[model samples]
Target: MCVVLAALLAFELFQPAHAQIPNAAQGYQRELTRVVQQEWGMNGRVAVHAAQIHQESAWRSNVNSPVGAQGLSQFMPSTSAWIAEIYPDLGRAAPYSPGWAMRAQARYNKWHWQQLASAADECQRWAFALSAYNGGLGWVNRDRRLATAAGDNPRVWFGSVEKYTHRAGWALRENRHYVRHILLTLTPRYERAGWQGGAPCNA
Candidate 1:
């Protein structure tokens, strides 16, 4: 009886909280899959991207944040315009269009990932990339510099660079939560649900 109880407790501890995928996420899976593959190749972190979209707008294509971020990917107007301008193939800035938003998000993630080559590992790199996505790459760089000055390893994220942020309290909290929620929480959930491209942090 004790052994059986221990096994049940272990199962409960290992099980994911909210393991079921959101219904709204179902409609965009195909498009997201294609965009992630197109941008990051076949082994792209599709589950991570899906979790990002879930965090951004909960797969709602028509929602808008009070801060003016719009649509499924929750891009601000200026950012949408900038992304479209820099990547001409993306054409006009249409944050409301599901197809456009998915592609733009995938492209933008690739862009950030490419710039964060100094991270200690893929997990650290993606944490920085996601932080850059939530806040800005400038903030990530600034925090890394601060971390270095404090004698911490700037290449690491968890207890290193994440502890050296200079942003406002609210901004810092949101940015940290955004990175953790997407990478540690939601990414694993999506991976277990059979989304392609396994979680990087888990890898």
Candidate 2:
């Protein structure tokens, strides 16, 4: 936690600033939790995923990113198109349907996890996998190899491997900050709910 806090306070690179959670999501919480738990596991990720959707798209069903990412998940066109192909029903109504968008986000988050295997516990898994969600899986793997080559623990995210992320071609401050922000802000909520990955988070 101290490491991430230092990174947040000392970062000199360009990462997009994010706003805090809205006071009222108007049922967004319950619905999002339901959708995420259904598609992902009943694990504590429901809150994390919901927080991500809040940060990513602010729960806007019709939101579009300047980079062509769209929907509640801020998924890129190519990614969403692929998501739609696999989740035909959910993708059919994406970007315009809040429910569908959340569903798609859940599925996509799962896909992100599958992109890499981890011997790390659930908490560390989120640190690595969420970085992949924001950066790219290939970049994360590349950084892992870089960390190993540099005599760092490839699986240690915050204090070790994350340092190598900035060296990867596509790894940027935004991706590093994304995982930190998510865990920092939402871990308590997940821990209170008895989620697997919520412990040891001082943030």
Candidate 3:
């Protein structure tokens, strides 16, 4: 009995593989939390990214950009197709299916994040990856190099790269909203976890 109980406990700790895919707005928050946690090394970072996604699309699974982006993560159709290639069955399936789109986007995000492994163990890595996820990695890389050369503080996002890309202005504004939403919603839990971004407002 004890062994069976232990196995159940272990199973309970992991979310279902499908937990990262959500169809309803109500479920997106939970699924986003799971995805962020899966992709990000830290819980706090996951919370932050989840908030960002909320800010960007309000958890809309079929959101389409005026320019051609599609799906929950607002991936360009080509990018979505590329991500779909990673899953053979999915490549044959509809790219706009909520579950397929979510999986593809998550895989793409994970790939993008991995490209910055040099920034491992640093919050800036998360920040930079988020920037690249919104903008493009090529632009973010240019900014990173310039910022590094100028002796700028590269640890925190300061909108320094906005000048480099026209898309960045909107991306920066959206990311700021993302940070705010996450901070507001998760502040209580983060504080309880000893969050240092600020003193607990309630305590």
Give the runs in model 2 whose Cα sits over 4 Å from its true position: 1-19, 89-93, 166-171, 187-203
Residues 40-72 of candidate 2 have per-residue lDDT tens digits of: 666546667766776787667677888888877
Query: What residue runs in model 3 are displaced by over 4 Å at the alpha carbon?
Result: 1-24, 29-49, 87-90, 93-95, 153-203
Each candidate's clash count: 0, 0, 0
Give the winner by lDDT.
1
- Give lDDT per model, in order: 0.87, 0.67, 0.52
Best by TM-score: 1
Residue lDDT tens for model 1, 1-203 = 12432453345337664465679887888889989998989998899999999999999999999999999999999999999999999999999999999999998888999999989999899999999999999999999999999999999887789989879999999999899778777887888777889877664
**Judged by TM-score relative to the true structure, which candidate is superior, 1 or 2?**
1
Better of 1 and 3 by TM-score: 1
Full-model lDDT, candidate 2:
0.67
Model 1, total clashes:
0
Q: Native-vs-model 3 lDDT?
A: 0.52
Q: Please write out the lDDT profile of model 3 over residues 1-203, one tens digit for every residue.
A: 12432453344335342333224544655554465455444443544444444545556766777877776667776666666676665565344566665555566667776887765234445556666776678867776666566765444343333323334467657654443333334333333333223211121
**For model 2, where is the 10-residue window of minimal lDDT?**
12-21
